[model samples]
Target: MSLAKQLSTLMIAAVLLGLGARVATHSDLPFWGHWEPIKLVAPPISIADDAMAKPDSAFAKSTSAYEVNLAATMVLHMKRNKSNIHFVDAREDTLYKAGHIPGAMNVSFDHIDKDGDKFLALPKDDLIVIYCDGGDCHLSHDLAEFALAQGYGRLAVFTGGWAEWSKETDLIETGSGAK
Candidate 1:
């Protein structure tokens, strides 16, 4: 067959197959399913706005200015300043042993309660930067929130966490786990 004719035939066949599947499945259309519209819900109240919200417990990431992490470079800056700040790693001990941000103490979520006294012992006004593996890891968030509950106010989540720190060759450590 001619080149143009062959190309046209191929295109037609693809379209027919697509139509066939749509009809067979009785679906909304290709690439979209069921034709059903998603239900929209009202946005939830911010934790800060809730009257019953415990001031001591919630990290209130969205509500507080100081609770959020400084940028990674700022964290490095803090490290070099000889400031009395704590770096906490919220990932697993095994991961912490493999590699973590330098000077970051391993404080995994699974053992937070066990390590409660250690954290509680720190001065509430001292700066603490909690981190984990980053990018979908919620350990830091949970731990920071928990710490806030325990009256540790000078909290910040190292938002970039270990993932960002690991990329900086000079900022990572190994075999630092207490285990």
Candidate 2:
């Protein structure tokens, strides 16, 4: 076979193998799923529908994720410690045990099937802030999407996650307790 033709055939075989493995494993990923079109601007704000949006809030909305800064996260963490708000750390147990926001719950995306119950128990309308390791972490976003799918009314993503929080605050709790 010619080089071009051989390469094309190899690519086709790889695709077929991938699809076969996906079918065999019964992966959660859909073979054909509806995708939202990419938009240049942020998604429309549904937060204003409820009274959740604050005049001094630093939150920005994108689909199911609401991005917040360190200041907002600190304010939310204060509420979390007072048991008025729920903050979920999407990092794994090991990382969580090493250090985490004092009252935040660790619900890892990798083990969502096991850790998902904590998320399910939360009130749908309650404001939940999810975070992971700062800078390019998607665990928080993944958990937020799952929460949104399960009818969570309000969700926020702390873009400056544990990395930022740990560095900026002294309220770090080591070891997993009752949370």
Candidate 1 residue lDDT tens string, 1-179: 99999999999999999889888989754475666432211122232343213322323333222333334334333443354567788888889999976667788887887866666776776666677887898788788777766766556666666777677546567897432
| Candidate 2 local lDDT, 1-179, one digit each (tens) | 89999999999999999989988998766568786532222232333333233512333323455666787677666656443468888999999999988878889999999989988988775677889998988898778878877877467778889999989888899899437
Where does candidate 1 stray beyond 4 Å?
Answer: 1-77, 177-179
**What TM-score, over all chains together, does every model reach?**
0.57, 0.70
lDDT of model 1 at position 155: 65
Error of 1 at 1 (Å): 73
Which ten residues in a row are the worst by lDDT in model 2? 37-46
> What local lDDT does model 1 show for residue 154?
54
Model 2, C-alpha of 163: deviation from truth (Å): 0.6
Model 1 vs truth, CA RMSD: 13.1
lDDT of each: 0.62, 0.74
